[model samples]
Target: MAREVDPKKTRKALRRLKRARKKIEDSEKSDTLSDWEDEFLGSVEDRLETFGSAFNDPEKGHLDEALSGLQTAKLREIERKAAGKARKPMSRGKGFKSSFKRKGSGPRVRDINEDIEEETPEADEIPEAAAEPSRPSGPPKLRVVKGDKGDT
Candidate 1:
């Protein structure tokens, strides 16, 4: 069964479709579109003429919407091409997720503390006094805990 559509939305979509058609036609006068692009425009116009919308799948768009999200995106792309823009290839974002964030994507900066640590000694550094370094029986920095509870 055909989904019911709003007449107002249908009229708006038709106007947009006509505008897209005009854009393609105007572009052809200066630079020609690929055979597929021309066919795509023709097919879209035909579909819109035959049916209220270009797409039949309800999941592709809302019942009242003339174009689906993807359809609108493609239309925009077509319009860009009509404006003589090059067809740039789609690329994945430089991220693990779509909305990923980070400090930067450039070369990593050296930590200031690393240079300081190399120049000086750290508390964690093993003493060179030991001829052979062995795991001591006690913690590295032994301290006596003196408290009222007689922990000392």
Candidate 2:
């Protein structure tokens, strides 16, 4: 026995499924902070809290400016550290040449010009239809391969 599905209910269900899928995709795409970011944010929060505590009711407006300046300085420091770390690898003498050569041995370099040239078909060349057979026209036929009973 088959139960009839209501068109209105089916449409509503599909809309809900689409919304759920969108929500999942959006959540996956949202920005996530790394360990360094978390640390930087924590430091900024601590500094802001301490700075805020030091000020009285008279200096609330000035406190905001000071906090902004502090944040900017901290951010600059973090950026400088990150940049320094990035440069460290390049600063080391072991560059591209050293990477390819055997360690503690004489430089056995290969000339790039000696490599074999590859022939590419010109734009005017049309590939044979036999190269790629057209998909079978009609419903796809499913094949079930029989395996040994012991295989499972």
Candidate 3:
């Protein structure tokens, strides 16, 4: 003979299902997604189906055990997947295009002499050539030798 459903247990299960659904909806709102929410929803749905199909009291305990395991694994899987997504941009260099110019683009042309000229003092500001040490205009004169004995 099949066991009959207890009214209290059935009502409690229904309330739990409703709460799980509400939690799932709330978790998915605006900016945050809870990793456990989907798992909880699926677990509740499975438990309700098991209760309906078995029509037995002892089966609820088995459903609870299975639900707990599934929910734990699902939460872990969601965390792993989320972490992988977070790591992708950092690992891939975040779309950095190389700034290096290609070969044959020719060397960069710049007015290097103009830059040097700007830093140099003006010619007029420098002292005239008169301030320079006077250099001998012609070859140096040779000295004549004198004989001590007056020999010609």
Model number with the top TM-score = 1
lDDT of 3 by residue, 68-128 (tens): 3444344444444333333223245534445654578767689778677456466677688
**CA-only RMSD, every prediction:** 8.7, 28.1, 21.3
Q: What is the alpha-carbon lDDT for the whole of candidate 1?
A: 0.72
RMSD of 1: 8.7
Overall lDDT per candidate, in order of appearance:
0.72, 0.46, 0.50
Model 2: worst 10 consecutive residues (lDDT sum): 52-61
lDDT of 1 at 54: 78
Which is better, 1 or 3, measured by lDDT? 1
Task: Determine the backbone clash count of candidate 2.
Answer: 0
Task: Estimate, for each residue in 10-111, the C-alpha lDDT of model 2 and write its tens digit.
Answer: 344334333433443455433333466546555544544444322234333343232343444444444444333322333467568767766677766898
| Runs of candidate 2 exceeding 4 Å displacement | 1-31, 53-64, 68-70, 73-152
lDDT of 3 at 98: 58
Clashes of each: 0, 0, 0
Considering only N, C-alpha and C atoms within 3 Å, which residue pairs clash in candidate 2? none
TM-scores of the models, in the given order? 0.56, 0.20, 0.26
lDDT of 1 by residue, 22-126 (tens): 886766465456777678777877777678777878788787776777877877787777777888899866677547555668867788877664455565685
- Candidate with better TM-score, 1 vs 3: 1
TM-score of 2: 0.20
Q: After superposition, which runs of candidate 3 have C-alpha atoms over 4 Å from their true positions?
A: 28-152
**Order of candidates by lDDT, top first?**
1, 3, 2
